[model samples]
Structure formats: C-alpha cells, structure tokens
Target: MEHRQLVHFLAVLDSGSLTAAAQRVGLTQQALSKSLSRLENELGGKLFERGTRGMTATRLGESISEYARDIIASAGKLRHTASAALGLERGRLVVGLSPISAASLLGKRLTQFAQNYPNVRIDVEGGIDRDFVAALHRGELDIALSSQVGGQYDGILLEQVFSEPWGVGGCVNNQALQDAQSISDLADGKWIIGRNTDLLDDIIAETFSNAGLPMPKPGIMTTSVLFSLHALSQSDFLAILPQSLCRDFNGILWRDLSDGAWISPIYMMRRRRAHMDELVSVLLRELKG
Candidate 1:
C-alpha cells in the first residue's frame, strides 16, 4: 500500500532473501517482515513464498510486478520533475552502453554531456544486449545504447541510431582468408564471438545452414569486445564484427559473407512512457548529433 513497501518488495525480489534485502534496504529483518506482512494484507493476497533457498514470487506477485515497477518509476519521475521545475540544473541519470558502442566514443560523449550539464550526475555501465534491457526494465537504467531489442522489453521504446553490415574478420595472415570467398570457404576455420543468446546463436546457425554449411562452433566465447578482437588478431578465430572496424584497425581482415546475411544495429532505448529527465535528454541529444 505504501511506496516504502513496494521498495522493500522489489529489494527482496531482487536480492532473493529477506536477510540480504533487509541489509540492502537499511532495515532489520523484523521490520522488513512487518512491511511485507502489511503489504500482503492490504492486497489480500500472498505475495511471496518463503523457503530456505529464498523468496519466490507467487502468481499474484508475478502479475503485479510490472505495475509495481511502473509505480516506482513514476514516483521517481515526479521527484525529478519537481526538482527540474525548481531549476532544471540538477538530476541523476544512469546510462547503459553496449560494449562496442561504449569503447567507440564514450569518453568524448560523456565529457561533452558533463560540460553541458555540470550539475547532473551520470553513471555509465557497459553490458550485453539482454543485461542492458533487463536494467532498463528494473528502472536501474534511464537510457541504453544497445543492439536492436525485441518484445521482451514490453515497456521500452527503441530508436535505431547506427547500422552497419557485420562481416567475418580474422588476422590478415590467417590461411583461411587466403582461400575464403564465401561462408563455405571458412567452414573449417575456428570462430570467436561475443556471448550468444539463443536468438543470436540461432540466427548464426540458420545462416550457415542456409548456405549448406555446418554451423561453425566458436573456439572462444567472450563478452568483451576487446578480447574477441584480440582473439581474431592473435589467433585464427574468424570473428563477427562491425565492418567499419576493418577500415579502422590494422592487421585485421574482414570479408563480407556471400549472402550478406548479417547487419549490426545499435539502438537508443528508453522507458516508453516515462518523462525524460533533462540530463538524459541532454545526453540523448548529444548522441543523436
């Protein structure tokens, strides 16, 4: 019923234990229990099932989770709105960046944002696509630059900013590049890639299958772009990368796939109905520029 109860509920849901959630929320176990009890009573439904492992949301709890998150986001936006009205000069924004996008121009972009909004506080975290989208849904991120998202993010809106063909890259001296004119030519080569969600992995597999080649297994899998690039440059792993990198970096060779089947798209995403904080707006504008 109370805002604090929802905060406690979310903390517990995220932490997975009353004890840990209590520690995070600066409350004793007893106090947190009282809050949860009151909330459950007010709603007339059992919210969570407790066990030695941790708390698991009940059916009702799961159904109401999204509404709880929206309420919290709206409350935070109201605070930011009031603060902005007093003097549009102070606010906080957390921005999530995809690894490649983060490494590209994060320093210059953040520097410009800070100069433009000296009173604003900015927190930046780099992550994979799913992690960034999860953070946005949890209300932990105000905006994110990530790969194109899907319906999994029910309340987020996306705008595509950068799109480039994805190509297979490897060390310039790799023997595979010497004979490779198509995906079939590289079938025997080792590949390296970033973390693959089932969706991305399936796409990669289908591309090879459509070419009548067996799916190439990645010899090295990593979440770090630098590591993936290093694997390509130092080893024989053919990696998927933005085609632009081949023009920028030396000692790497990129060749377009025979089918031209892959393109990497970077998107700017935010909560669909939330009010844009001034600081977030400033950074978004700079990114668009």
Candidate 2:
C-alpha cells in the first residue's frame, strides 16, 4: 500500500530472492518480508510464489507490476527534474535495444556517454522489438532502439536513426553460392532462416516480392542468431539478415540482393508527451551522430 512496500515488492521481483532483494533495497530480510506481508494483506492476495530458484510473481503481482514500474518511473522523473533544476547532474536512465541492434550499436557512444555523465546510471535491456516496446510503454525504459514496421504504436514517437538493408548472407568459403547476387540468384541455394517474427518474415517476403522471385522455403529454422550464423558458415544455406550483424564474423559474407529498396528501418523511440531529459538528449545526440 505504501510507496516503500511497492518498492520492496519490485526489488524482490527483480532480484528474485529475499536476501538479494534486501541487499538491493538496503533492508534486512525480515524487514523486507514484513513489508511484503503487509502489502499482500492490503491487496488481499499473495504477490509472489517463492521457490528455491527464485520468486515468481503470481497473477495479481504480474498485473500490479506494470503500475508499480510506472509509479517508480514518475517518481524518478520528478527527482531528475528537481536535480536538473538544481544543477546536480544525476539521474538513472534505462534503455531498451532489440536483439539485432543491441550489439551493433552502443559501442563507442555508450562509453562516451558514461564518461560525460559520470553521475547518471545507465541500464540496458535487450530483446525483440515487441518486448522492447511493451517495456517502454510500462515506463521501464526511457529510450528504445528497434526495427519497427511503419506506424504501429500510437503511444510512442519514433525517429529513424539507421536503416538495415536485408541481405542474403552466406559463408565466404561457400563455393556453392558463389554466383548468388539476388533473391533469384539464391533460388537453388539452401536457406537457413531464424526466428519467424512477424516483421522479419514480412521483410523476407517483401524482399522476394520486390525481386520478382518466390520466397525460398527455409531448410532449417531456429531462434538463435549465433547458431544461424554458424550454420551459414558450415553449410550453403543463405540467411536474410542485416549487414551490420556480419561485421565482426570474419568468415561470413553478406551479399546485397541488389534490391536496395528493402531496408528495415531502425527507430529510436520514446514515450509521447514526455519532456526530453538532458541526459536523454545527450545520448540521442550521440546516437544521431
């Protein structure tokens, strides 16, 4: 019921253990338990089911968690606004990044941001775009970088930062696909598709349609990007992926389909109607550069 109780509950959910949560919130285990007990009594339901591995949120807890995060976010924003007005230069920033964009981005700029804002704590969460957007809406993230389909969520405003042109990537040493240049060129080639997300699949379909070719049925499918990359290296299967992903992998060869039009737009998104914090502006400036 109290702000402290909600904070303790969230800590427990995040830490997944009474001892860890207590340590995180700077409270004794007994005290944390008492707070949780009082909260549950007020709410008339158990929040979490404890286990040896960790504490799992109950159905009611799951529903309440989103509101708790929003409350905490609003409180933090207030603190940040007051601190900025006082020239204290301190606040917390949580960012979300999609799976593909997470690794390629946030290298040099992240370090520079850290160096510039020594007092601002930064936390990053990586996942698919759907998960990232959901977290963004729940106020768990201030900024999110993800490949988005044109105009979906009305709650957030998006700015295009980068364009990831889809390419049919193969291994450098794979002689079987040496002649492949476009989707039609890869007709006879084995395809190793990964996670069948809606956006990705749509891009694949559109790419093939643009090339005036039929979509190649995938010979193998899995969710792991590493596994997909490794499969491409070892086999002749061609994968549809961004060129950014292959920059570090030496043996991988990303062949542009000559279809320049099929590029997935990577967007920097934030909640609408929210004032842009100075810290966020700093990060955004770096990203835009």
Which candidate tops TM-score? 2
Candidate 2, superposed: residue stretches over 4 Å from native: 1-38, 45-70, 82-90, 105-108, 115-119, 148-151, 195-203, 206-212
Per-residue lDDT tens digits for candidate 2, residues 1-289, read 6877888888888667899788756799999999999999999999999888889999999999979977866866775576466442677777887766665554446666878878878887766565555556545678888774445676778888876766778899876556665567666778887754466677778777876877887798778888888888887778877777876787898877655755777788887755577777778889777
Error of 1 at 118 (Å): 4.2
**Top-lDDT candidate index:** 2
Candidate 1 lDDT tens digits, 31-85 = 9999999999999999999987899999988888889888888776776686467
Score residue 41 of candidate 2 by CA lDDT. 98
lDDT of 2 at 214: 79
Off by over 4 Å in 1: 1-54, 58-71, 86-90, 104-111, 115-118, 196-212, 221-226, 243-253, 258-261
Q: Which 10-residue window in model 2 sums to the lowest lDDT?
A: 79-88
Query: Candidates' TM-scores?
Result: 0.67, 0.73
